[model samples]
Target: MAKNKSKKKYISGSLLFLLAFCFYMVFGPGRHRHQPKRQDTEIKNNEAKSSKDNTPLRELTTFTGKVTAIKDGDTFEVLFDGQPEKVRLADIDCPEKSQAFGKNAKQYASDLCFGKEVTVISTGKRDRYKRVVGTIITADSINVNREMIKAGYAWHYKQYSKSKELSQIEDEAREAHAGLWADAHAQAPWEWRKEKRTKKQQVSNQ
Candidate 1:
């Protein structure tokens, strides 16, 4: 009788240990798998937040200000809220001050808006130099950006603008041999800047 009782007790203990091992094998890995999924979700949310923070916020902005200074054919300074804010003409790129017809483009812009109260309709985009990109409307209700293209002093800047009116104006100017169009080979401002950078790099290499 004593031997039988000992044998029964040993069998019961062995059964309990087997049940515990099975339970752990079923639940342990499942719990660990869920932990990684939660971590992945948190990481994705953080990445989305970081991307939003890095992007620039843009809106339409308008203001009326006096043309305080003319920087070039496509840029100028406007007095707004008692400060001179630099404004870049949207949808156009003009010749650099050193390029052919560059001086003429600057003079044309000055004649159109210098010392005049102009309305600026900005796309609220800032260039690398942080100048407001926009259109300038003179007190006489003239669209200065359109006039620049109409006179062939500025390129339509198709990469940034898709205005058909501007495209047509540029075509008319080119056909009439107006302003810079008079030259048989008028290079775009972007190409001109690229050439200058290449030349500078070559000089530095020397």
Candidate 2:
């Protein structure tokens, strides 16, 4: 009877050991069933928060400020948060300094942005001169760059960038023979720059 009792105790102990091992296998350090769901919830919440934070109603591409000084027909330096920022009007190339319409272009640009607070919308890059090229808009919602083109003081560079409305306005201005449009014989500013450089080189060679 004593031996039989000892055997029964041994068998019961073995059964308990087996049960504990099975339990450990299902809920041990290697188990990942519950962890994945928690991680998934955290990721979703973070994504939602990021989306909300970045959602824009109307994005101003660049900072808004007052136009302090007009440099040329298509370029000016704006007085922003504190410092002066040079900005070139995108998609509009005006007469060169040596051209007939040069003074008119500078005067027009000065009239448009000088002393007025305007929004500078960027095209995401800068020119070689480190000026942030963009379209300037006034508080009254006028696109000064497009206005210059429409008034024929400028020609469409069509290279830096262009919007549909601006392109159309420039086309109409060209067709209507406005401002510099009065003379179709004028060369583009880019071509003029090249010619000026070539002449300078010839003079230097001489």
* TM-score of each predicted structure versus truth: 0.71, 0.67
Give the residue spans of candidate 1 off by over 4 A. 1-60
Give the range where candidate 1 is weakest over 10 consecutive residues by summed lDDT.
52-61
Q: 37-135, model 2: which lDDT tens digit per residue?
A: 899999999999999877643322578999988888988888887878888888889997669899998998888778999999995567787788788
lDDT of 1 by residue, 54-168 (tens): 7653343799989989899999999987878889999999999999989999999999999999999986878888789999999899999999999889999999999998999
Give the CA lDDT, 0 to 100, for residue 28 in model 1.
Answer: 72
Error of 2 at 155 (Å): 0.9
In candidate 2, residue 193 scores what lDDT? 91
| TM-score for candidate 2 | 0.67
- Give me the overall lDDT of model 1: 0.93
